[model samples]
Target: MKEQSSRKGFAKFTTLDIVLMAMLAAANAVMTVYLSQVNQALNGLGGPIATSTITGLYMIYGLLAYYIIRKPGTALITYGIGAVVQSFMGSAYGILSCFAAAACYLIIAEAVFAAFRYKNWSLPVMMFTGGAMVPVWFFFAAQMFGYTKWGTGVLLVALCVRIMSGILLCGLLTKLLGDALSRSGLLRRFAVSRAVES
Candidate 1:
């Protein structure tokens, strides 16, 4: 059946789709700047923190994008694009590493999704993807900004923050955005496929 064979029908994205993705990127960029400021303000208060964890929230954007689009490049494109937007908006992470981390997110996500036939769509996997992207961000940060300030406890602090941010923020944000997209009829394409599968 032509209807059954139409991949486009299952996920037909338009200008609105692209625009929405870019808007999300901008929103995420603004969020990062705000979060960083908050982190800076609370540094001396010792609110149980580490090197830098907002990168976890950064990955959340990809999670949400991929979840909604259910497309191969959605995670990669949106996030990479987001970073570019973030840099132009004056991100502390800089344009280069933001792009690098975005590339890593996209690549890792593609591999993960492929392994699952692109149908697993589970929370754990989302967290794994988020965590996987952590090093890219941290390493980039360390290289560009240096972690000497954190002293002898840098590794422990960085890893802990990675675990917390990746597992919690990215995964939760993905679930939230995915749910919202489904409710908005944007995921109708998925519904058609599942109905036939059942």
Candidate 2:
């Protein structure tokens, strides 16, 4: 009989990890609501780019949580918590839609991390994951807003814009934020903290 391979990396979740996940999830919810409000305010006046520019910011919490926790299921848990918080805060899309979007992001993020065996925390891999999230993001948005019939050219353009935004906001900006937090000594126990320290 073949022996079962242990999920050694996912063996446990410390109290500290749980606390950090909760805090990060709440932070993401607040930031997402605030940014969405800003986007709505400037949307029509400033053009579509105004809202799209911040699309990547939506992935920030998930990225940070994954980096800090370095464990499987972190994305799902954090994003799920954030979705609930956003719904309660009166998000324009309602609770279900918020959760749906968060789920989509989680699916993509989790798959990407799994592909790398959760070992590649390099900036390039993070950026790739960020960019990869655009397709899923666009899919849910299209369904929610009834944009499923958008022409190919238009959809392509929109996807490209989102990918660009993801790289900038989720990828580079996330790294910057992580670096700052790591430097503050708050993330000393996390793997990402060591990367920053070195």
Model 1 stretches astray by more than 4 angstroms: 1-13, 51-53, 148-152, 184-198
What range of 10 consecutive residues in model 1 has the weakest lDDT sum?
A: 189-198
The local distance difference test score of each candidate is 0.68, 0.80
Q: Per-residue lDDT of 97-182 in model 2, one digit per residue for the tens? A: 78888888899989999999988888898888888877886887887876657677666776788889898888777777877888
**lDDT (C-alpha) at residue 115 in model 2:** 95
lDDT of 1 by residue, 12-109 (tens): 66665577678778888888888877777666565335435554776787767776656666766688778788888886656776787778777777
Give the clash count for model 2.
0
Clash pairs for candidate 2? none
Off by over 4 Å in 2: 1-11, 149-151
